[model samples]
Target: MDSNKAKNLEQILESSIKDPKDLTRYLYYRKKLKEEGLSDFISILPLGAAINWARANSVWPLTFGIACCAIEMMAVGASKFDLDRFGSGVFRATPRQTDLMIVAGTVTYKLAPRIKKLYEQMPSPKYVIAMGACASSGGPYTQLGYQVIKGVDKIIPVDVYIPGCPPRPEALIDAVLLLQDKISKTIPQQEAI
Candidate 1:
């Protein structure tokens, strides 16, 4: 369907829903469909939907782990956890070649500059996932250490923050999936590297 038709249909649906939760759910799905470049009539047909699906499933995260959390990040890629199932097991060594950056450890003041540099190297519409307590908030060293950054976000814009001293492999997988969901909803501004 055309954009105008889709908008009319959305208005009808929004007006018909009285319950707040149901309306919210409806709006969320509608937004998801729109992000994928689909309308109610075109959703069944695969055009724009296929492109978004491919983008969502084929996220290549840069291999840039720093501290103890790096070990957990590795575990997620191991056969036992199998991050490949999420289509994000391939960790590119080059920042220029990847879309997702998983900062899986502590970021000290000294390392913040390098992190920011790497983030800037990533192509447009890139994403960062802060994947540990230390990376997210400096963990136990938040107050005591002057060298450690309170959070990686101080250096780069973090899209998802996973809270754990060193989060379990399962948590990393969940974070990747969540990042995938976010990617699916976004309209890429540039071609994938």
Candidate 2:
């Protein structure tokens, strides 16, 4: 069979196989085709854009809570605020499984290295939200305390900074929405011709 026919057959086989690994590989190729602008024939399904939209909406956050702000962070997941509405209420316990890392408390100098390690463990395209004054700038400890790190950004690259000793749940929700907006605007990398 010609290359195009062979590829089509492979896609069909993969789709029907019911194996998670095969499905993942098929999806990867589909994403590549869309990125190269070679998927006009498949325009009926904007798979690439749909994938990006799904990713932006369903951001799974890593669970990392350090101090008082941790309380506020938890509050965001409670029913009253309903962070699930934004598709980010599910907090993953493992760094490898999450795309967002919320630094929700004060970071001490001793813990900075550990936090950095955790951030490094996360996969690429991951985001970090510094979720309180303590996490953003060490709160009352900034410059005055010897043990507290001035900011979480010093340890890991922070994407958003929510200010407040312990920011209201609504503020956290706003930060998440802003992150979703940022995620939605990202352009997929084009494959080299």
Candidate 3:
């Protein structure tokens, strides 16, 4: 239905619910529907919902991995784990062609500048996922003097941090899912006339 009608219906339902538990449940589901991009309030959107939905589904990650986590990232792309099912299996070799960066390994101070440069090359609305303890916080290499960068986030803004010595492939998949949810919530800038 239309936005106004939907809002009115929602108000009526919320007002009519005498039980606090039922009202809470209704609000929770309503928020969940909006996050899932299934809400009927699309009329109020600046046509951004459709674009956000597409971005959420078709995330192309940059094919740059630094450590052992790269192996797990590769496994996620393989047929068994099947990351392609989520439309994020095609990892691009260049930052210009990708919207997602999965820092899947340790980040050394020497490599931090390159990571920052790559992140800068990415298009607007790009996302970064730190996919291992190393990438997230230097992992076991944190004490290696001025070698390990401590965290990839020190160079680029990370959207999700999956912690593990080298997080499992399943963890990478979950991080992608989490990133999709974050992308879906973004309100795009309305186009000027």
Candidate 1, superposed: residue stretches over 4 Å from native: 1-48, 190-193
What would the per-residue lDDT of candidate 3 be over residues 1-193, giving only the tens digit for each residue? Answer: 6999868745744664567986787678777878989777543222355578788999999998887999989999999999999999898898899999998887877888888899999988789999899888888878865688888877788899999877778888999999998887666655611
- By lDDT, is 1 or 3 better? 3
Give candidate 2 misplaced runs (Cα > 4 Å): 1-48, 191-193
CA-RMSD of model 3: 9.1
Determine the backbone clash count of candidate 2. Answer: 0
Among these predictions, the greatest TM-score belongs to 3
The residue-by-residue lDDT of candidate 2 on 29-136, one tens digit each, is 778888989887653223444556778999999889888888878888888989988899899998999999999988998898888899889987799999998888
**Quick one: RMSD of model 2?**
11.2
Question: Per-residue lDDT of 1-193 in model 1, one digit per residue for the tens?
Answer: 6999867744644664467987777677767887887665554322333456787898899998898999888888889999998889799999999889999888887787888899999987688899989988889899999899898888788899999888888888888888877765554343441
Q: TM-score of model 1 relative to the true fold?
A: 0.74
Per-residue error for 1 in candidate 3, Å, reads 21
Displacement of residue 110 (Cα, Å) in model 3 is 1.3
